[model samples]
Target chain A: MRIVVDLNRCQGYAQCVPLAPEVLKLNGEEALTYNPNPDDAQRLRVLRAAAACPVQAIIVDQLDLKK
Target chain B: MSSPTNGNALKDKGRIVIVGASLTGLRAAEALRKEGFSGHLTIIGDEPHEPYDRPPLSKQVLKGWVPADHTKLPRMLEVHAEWRLGVAATGLDRAKKVVRLADGDEVPFDRVLLATGVRARQWPNPAQAALEGVYTLRTSNDAARLQAALAAGPRRVLIIGAGFIGSEVASVCRELGLQVTVAERASAPLAGALGEVIGAIAAEMQRDAGVDLRIGVSITALEGDASGHVRRARLSDGSTLEVDVVLASLGSIRNIEWLEGAGLAAGFWGVGCDAGCRAFDIHGIVTDHIFVAGDIARSPHVLFEYQFLSMEHWDNAVLGAEVAAHNMVCEEIERRAHLLVPAFWSAQFGVNIKSVGVPSFGDEIVFTQGSRKERRFVAAYGRRGRIVGAVTCNNGKWLEYYGAQIARSGPFPPHPAGFDLPGDMRVVPAEFPARGVPTAAPDVVLTGHDPSERHAEFRPRAR
Candidate 1:
């Protein structure tokens, strides 16, 4: 699974920071600073982080095995 | 037209995504489940905590009667669903049927509900906003922090807005035996919502409560200590007040950034939706799968001549959530309309102020029942010779009757029995302040911008 965040729309609400701190973090200015693509093992954390966004800004893409 | 037999098409439970995990989101979730929605349910929120009550934050919580975190809203029923706490939705991909989050993850949903509420508007100047002692009250954490600061016993408290929150803060300050000062950009307190005459009464109430109320004054600059703690505020009227704490209760901004390219009928005013809670796109086309509710939801009112109304009251959140929930899972024919009349209340300065309907929609006001001097009166607001709103000071019992009349589009100066009728029955101009300007209270605004643009403007820009 791969995660792709649109930095332009994130307001750094930090709702995802707590849910998946390893993947999503906030900078000193409190803007959302996150990893674009995490390993497959951290897929659940990525999903949870996406679910926690109030503005629904996060997006997770399932990797296709054939590709 | 046999009722558009699409019930069977929706029988297969679909994924429902609700943005915002506050009062409206929680209640709507419970409503969806209660209405037999077995589809996958996902609730997304920017706050880490579960949905909680916000009304008590300014009153009981701040007064130390209840802890801010403990002011959780009572769950009417259990809503078993995926709890997405702490992440913010950044974009909406309507064609893909997905909601994008900041972490670059997308949640696929057949239907979506935009319950993302509003946030407290901050002071414009970055230097003043960065001052440590200056604060804006909106979230639970904000209330908790401010409550602790107030308990620390600052020398004096200065409030820069006289809206309900600011007024209530002053009332709380009095209860705490602390000296308080209120400065408003408007001509009088509550002039934006209730107009000049009623605003004058409110201004008097604040003065009577010993608040150094200053109207028609704007904060030019906020001076801070060496450590960046606010020390004094310079007013536009060429006066400065030495204060230890400063609170800016300017108003609130809707939380709508996530719907940037989702291309819904969303703007600065809020996401436009029908009375049935279904969201409309920019072109005004209603989509069945998308819905909206709560403080962020803007819909038209039948009683107010089909003018879109946006409300931030607690009652509207509860009522709007229920209606949105019912319409989300049910068929179009079985769906319900969210025509709930707006109502709100505030306990300040030994007065229990309650109001039904949107007073700003009214053009005139009359002292229908009780006297303003006694601080126990019911003022009726009229628009085009019909009662549209009513407010009662320390007299809430008569609100229901007036509310019903407003809901039913009753006559101006509603004549409910048991009140002395004045032979001269005249209505006076409310003299409300112009829209989109600074005032004492939060005006229901339509920001006419995408959620993303709204948030971007608030972001600290590089020099």
Candidate 2:
């Protein structure tokens, strides 16, 4: 699984931080930091955090079977 | 008649129509598509633009950090639906299962989601409100106009109310190096939402930021120039300020007027709904086909003594929309609750305030961490011995912890951990305004509490 957050679109609402702590975290300055790819176990939460984003800055792209 | 969507011709997935194509409506459409519900979908919106994020309209957009039009919410999901933009839903025809649009067109639906949301409350005097410099912040266009006015360097800006939006606008004005005066009728800023105790701390923040904060006073009238632009404002305290810009942050009015004769339990408190987001009829019976979401929804919370909860916060709108969407296509047993642990965040006066749950639901509050003197602390609000709400200033990481406590229904005045507790951790009355105040409380109110509603099962709490 791959997760991507658009730095330009991110408004720092921090709604994503608490939902998937292991996959995403807000630094001391409240700027978003995250693991772009993670194990499948955290897949549901990552997608949820992406959807919960008010700005929809988080984009979780599924891997291509061909790739 | 509109042509049927291609997928609908092959299979019967049913037709779903959504009104109010903003955040909630857009999110709900995404959820429906994600849930594998391929159906005929139609989204009706009164605004010309597509869905957009509103939180930044007061913060970054106003501060010139982001363009007002650039804040449109990204459409992450592939929703193949017909779009009806820039047209209002004038009425609902439930028996015929159709929506009446302003253009005299009726869109049939197997089910519909009412996410009409709310609009900013207009200033009482319509004539004065029509003045060129007078404004209210609720839409992208409103922010754009307000931002342009600020860019012109107004000598002074008069903010009429001290609600969340009002306070944030003042913060932006300060950031722009502009002089701003805040006139709040309550005892303190944010007195209605956060109560007087926390409002005091907010008041100090506004004052320290060089704002002319006026409490316990009301605007008598606004005086405009002959050019039809606002020039000055008169106050009840016998004071007049020559201000170029006037912002009325008085509050919001739910956009449920069209649902009047449609037989849904809708009124000033918004539309009443069940836990699963199913709308209740005018006679108090849950309707399977009609659902409600976003700020216009006032569904009961099981944890908060079954009190109906309505919030204009971003979190609730997204979560509620998803829940309503899920319930629309699923069986009764598969439905879920929109029981989001209501959370919100606001950055103003260099202080980041975050909170979870309904703080206004509590009768008493106590600061569990940090100190008020330092303007950084965590306060817990409790009622009937259970922690109902909490607020944190510059300490949002702890929001999840208190949210759990609120969900657990922990004891109030939480027992001091045997050590490191502040010496003067005293409890105080929340001091919310009396029940009758128009804008003091959130849009949440018991449908039964209203005298006219005969079928509601709620009694107004003694204030």
lDDT of 2 by residue, B1-463 (tens): 3333333331246789999999899889999888777878999999998887787688777876556775666565678989999999999999998999999999999889999999999898999999999999999999899999999999999999999999999998998999999999889998888889999999999999999999999999999999999999999999999999999998999998788678788877899999899999876889988999999999889889898888787878888999998888776577798887887877788777878889999989988887688766788898988888888777666667788888888788875444335557788898887655443332323466567764533322332
Alpha-carbon interface RMSD for all candidates, in angstroms: 19.5, 8.0
Q: What is the DockQ of each candidate?
A: 0.01, 0.08
Give me the displacement of residue B216 in model 1, in angstroms.
Answer: 0.9
Native-referenced TM-scores of chain A, all candidate models: 0.81, 0.86
lDDT of each: 0.79, 0.82
Best by DockQ: 2
TM-score attained by model 1: 0.81
* Fnat per model, in the order shown: 0.00, 0.00
The CAPRI-style docking tier of model 1 reads: incorrect
